[model samples]
Structures are given as structure tokens and as C-alpha cells.
Target: MQNFKAMVLLQIIISIFLFLSQASSQGIGDKSNVPEYAWLAGNWSGNGFGGTSEESWSLPSPDGTMMGMYRHLDSMGNITFYEFLLLDETGIRLKHFRPDLIGWETKEDFVTFEMVRYNGKIIELKGLIFKRKSENEMEILLKLRKGDVVKTEVFTMKKINKLK
Candidate 1:
């Protein structure tokens, strides 16, 4: 009887802990403490990889999620690839796809990028950086790593919409 009571108490404690943890995560996922990146909500086009790169970010929703999309066209103006991005207080989650919408990663896999810094003017992810140059110009610096070789690729983007 004593062992049964102890087990029941332990289970209750574990349940409470799990509940609190989940609640905390939800709270953090909201805008309670996340920086304002709404300025990024617009169409932006850039040049890189010998092609033109276009990206668009949506305004954050009530649930604190911002959706972003990216596509690159070759110098000949042929579509090359696409990327879908999900942004939240924690970081950015991204997935790659071919022009046909076929995924580069498995359905269960995505690339996670943690924010290194964000100060309204600049946002830095683990291996990527977004720096606002002016009201309508932004620069993107990406660090590409392979084996032991790391290369930096820079993209200069101009916001397509009238600056808000």
C-alpha cells in the first residue's frame, strides 16, 4: 500500500512538471520577449550565386509566427530553387526545395538556425547575418561550410516595396 501511494505521488509530480514546462515554452514562443522584426515583413530581392535571389517575409501573426519564402533564379532568369522559412521567438526553421516543390530534406527534417543577435537593425543567426543598410537596402551574409572549408557569400538586397 505504501509503495502504491509513493508511485502515485511521483506520477503526479512528473505530470505537474511537464505541464509547467509546456506552458513556459508557449509563453516564450510568443512576442512577450521577442524582438520586433516586423520591419522585415516585405518583399526583398538580392543578387548572389551568379543569380538573382528573392525573399519575402510576412508580418508576425497573433500566434507569433512569421512565414518567409525565398527563391533564386539563374542569370538566365530560370528558377533554380526555393526555401520556406518559419520564424518565431526562438529562431528560424528552414526547409529547401527544388523549383518543382520537391523537398531537399526528408519530411521530418529541417535546418534550425538559432538567433545570435537581433537589435532591430541587424539580425544574426548561427551561420547567417542580416544587416539593414538603409530604409530600403539590406545585406545578407551567409557562411557556407563544407568539410573544413568555410566560405562567406554576400548578397545585397533592396526592399521592393515602399519603405514602411
Candidate 2:
């Protein structure tokens, strides 16, 4: 019985070690071949997060940077929150703000999501994935973390000429 218990403890320890290693490596990836996000450039909106979610992306600029912005609204069309997104050689960094443009984090802090997979149509970031369903349609999956809990939000958005 003693030997069996010891073996079980050893196995648990090994499992935990492996899990920690993988978790720590989540946002680290090869940045040399970050593809241009021309497919994602446009205005996108859909139902998400208890209301409507909108995202606007800019084409790759001559300075080699892509910019985006996001906004979430309530059913009544009241602004709930906003986010500024940027993609560059480093990674995708985003900052959250309230409707009044008050930041949610410290001035120097922003959430960074690293690119993990890209195969033309599908681009997977550390905790976010963009799947191009068609030229005018896209599926976005975002992993939101709070404390020890994690939730995934799926948004299906279509390209629009402007935000509605």
C-alpha cells in the first residue's frame, strides 16, 4: 500500500510539472513570419457578450503595423466597453477602456496575445483565433480569463462598410 501511494504521488507531481511548463509557454511563438492580416481588414460586427460586438481593422501600413479597435454594446445600443488593438513585430497588444475612454489597466500595461498558428484562412493567437469563413464573414474565438476561471466567447461577424 505504501509503495502504491508513493507511485501515485510521483505521477501527480510529473503531471503538474508538465502542465505548468505548457501554461507558461502559451504566449511564446515564432515571430519571424507573422503574416499580413489583409483578410481581417474591414469592419466586423456580430452578436457577442450579451450584446453586439464590433471590430474595425486597418490594412497593413507601410510602417508594418496593423491597427484595430473593438467595442461592445448592450441591446439598447449603449456602449459597454472598448479596446484598442495593435499588431506589430512583437505581438498583438490590446488595451481595454471604458466608454468614456478610461483605461482598465495601468498606463504601461496591455494584454499581449502571441500568434501560434497561421494557415492563410485561420490565424490562432495565444488565447484568440480568427477563422475566415468567407471573404465577408469571419469567426472569432476569444479566451477570457478571470481569476481561476476561463471562458471562451465566439463571435460571428460580417464585413460592413461602416459601424452600425
Candidate 3:
């Protein structure tokens, strides 16, 4: 009888603790605290010299962030390049992390950037402005110490059909 009572008490205490923990996680907070990257929620496709590539991304919450990854491989089935979405509080960012799996760790040319503007056409981040052409294309133009150059890339994605 005593053992049964002790087990019941323990179960009740555990249930209460679990309920409180879940409730705390649902508390209201600033939108930034949760992630404001809701623009990338969709399926996307693009092509380049490496070959055709596709990616998909969606956020768990309607007001949360979205992310995606893509792979473009060579004829031999070896990945020649890869790209992924980068969504931060500042803005939506994209990164092509690796050109090839071979010795990629030695390459420090990669950078971390965030979005500063979300006007749907021009996104400014880290003092650089990216112009958007259509829903899946963007170009970055900036002045360099050596000269001025413009880098352009195209992305295609559709918001998860199930989500409105």
C-alpha cells in the first residue's frame, strides 16, 4: 500500500513539472527573440555550370524563419558545390559554403552576412546592397579597393504548399 502511494505521488509531481515546463516555453516574447525570417518558406530550383539544383525551406512557425540547402554534383556524382540559406534577425542571407569537399576547410574566403533591408527589391546588409530581380534572383554590387564588381545569383523557392 505504501509503495503504491509513493509511486502515485511521484507521478503527480512529474506531471506537474512537465506542464509548467511546456507553459514556460509558450510565453509571449519579442518577435526578434523567435526569428523573423519568414520569407524563405518554399521550394526552389536553379541551374549553373555545375548543373541543375533544387532546394526547399520552411519555418515551423508562421512568424519564424526558414532555411534550405542544395547540392550540385558533377557527372561522376561527386558534389561540386553546395549552397544553403542563412536567416538571422537582421535579414535573409545565403551562403555557398563549399566549392568542393576537397580541402574546403582551408578556404577562408567565405563570409557571414545578414539582411538589413526587406523592401523585396533592395536588401542592404553589412553596408552592401543587394538588388532583387523577380522573386528568386538577386545581385550584389559593391566597390572594392581594387575595383568595382557585381556578383549575381538566382534562387527559386515556393512556400510550403500546406502553409498559407
Candidate 4:
């Protein structure tokens, strides 16, 4: 009778372990679903804050990674600054680069914005948010802070071309 009780207890423990393992695996698999914001994959241009800006985005990969490049040009069409962007399950990462390929951040450091929320057309990433206004239009809101001063900027983008 003692041997039978021990065997039953061991079986129950094994079953519970298997169940927990399967549940954890499923939760991880769900993160790979491509975000509906994939609609951002395209060439976009706009004028804002005294400059003309152009941005290009790539469609999200199966693993939920999307890449983007941005250029800010003066009214005379001279390049002012550039930015590289990445979106993934971890969050949104941004790095500023000069026209000469010099990076603003250290080789091991980049700005990260944790994803706070998302719907089919809008994604909020901490202080930065993006909203798809329509098939050809989008809006970006950025909140910047320096010591005790805070500033907010809004940019409206119009689709210039769709990604192939």
C-alpha cells in the first residue's frame, strides 16, 4: 500500500510539470504574431518643425521585427539628421545617426521605449506613440524631457509609396 501511494504521487507531479511547460510555451509563441501596425511598411514624407522629413519602414518579420529609417532635411533640402528605428517584442529602439554614419549613442547603448499598448491602428510606446490615421496618413507623437523641462511634438506623415 505504501509503494502504490508513492507511485500515484509521482505521477501527479509529472503531469503537473508537463501541463505547466505546455502553457509557458504557448505564451511565448503568442508574442511572435505580426503586429497589425505592419501597415506602416512604406515610404512616407512630411513637413514638420521647420523641416521636411522622410521615413521608410519595412514590413514586420515573422518574428515581429520591423526596421525603419528616417531623414530630416532643411527647407533647402540639405540633410539635417537621420534616425534608425527598430520595433520588436522587447520594445521600440531608436538610434540617431549623422549623414557621415556617426552614431549619437555609444556602440552598446541605444534609446528604448517599452511598448505600453497597441490596437489594430495605433501603438503606444512609452513616451512615443504612433497612430495610423488612414491608409495614406499617419501621426507620430513624441514627448521629450530634459531635466525639469518637457516638450511634445507631433508629426503628420503622408504615404509616398508602398513597400513592394
- The global C-alpha lDDT for each of the candidates, from Candidate 1 onward, is 0.86, 0.82, 0.53, 0.85
Candidate 4: residue 3 lDDT (0-100): 100
Rank by TM-score (best first): 1, 4, 2, 3
lDDT of 3 by residue, 61-159 (tens): 533555656576565666676766555556545557557544333355434466666544565666445455545554444433334754444433232
- Residue 64 of model 2: what lDDT? 49
Task: After the best TM-score superposition of candidate 4, give how far the Cα of residue 88 lies from its true spot, in angstroms.
Answer: 1.6
- Per-candidate TM vs. native? 0.76, 0.73, 0.45, 0.76
Give stretches of model 1 more than 4 Å off. Answer: 1-34, 162-164
Give the local distance difference test score of model 4: 0.85
**How much is 39 displaced in model 4, in angstroms?**
1.4
Model 2, residue 147: what's the lDDT?
A: 100
After superposing candidate 2 on the true structure, give the runs of residues whose Cα lies further than 4 Å from its correct spot: 1-34, 162-164
Question: How many steric overlaps are in each model, in order?
Answer: 0, 0, 7, 0
lDDT (Cα, tens digit) per residue for candidate 2, span 113-147: 99776665987888998899987899999999899
Question: Each model's RMSD to truth, in Å?
Answer: 7.4, 15.9, 7.5, 6.1
On lDDT, the candidate that comes out on top is 1
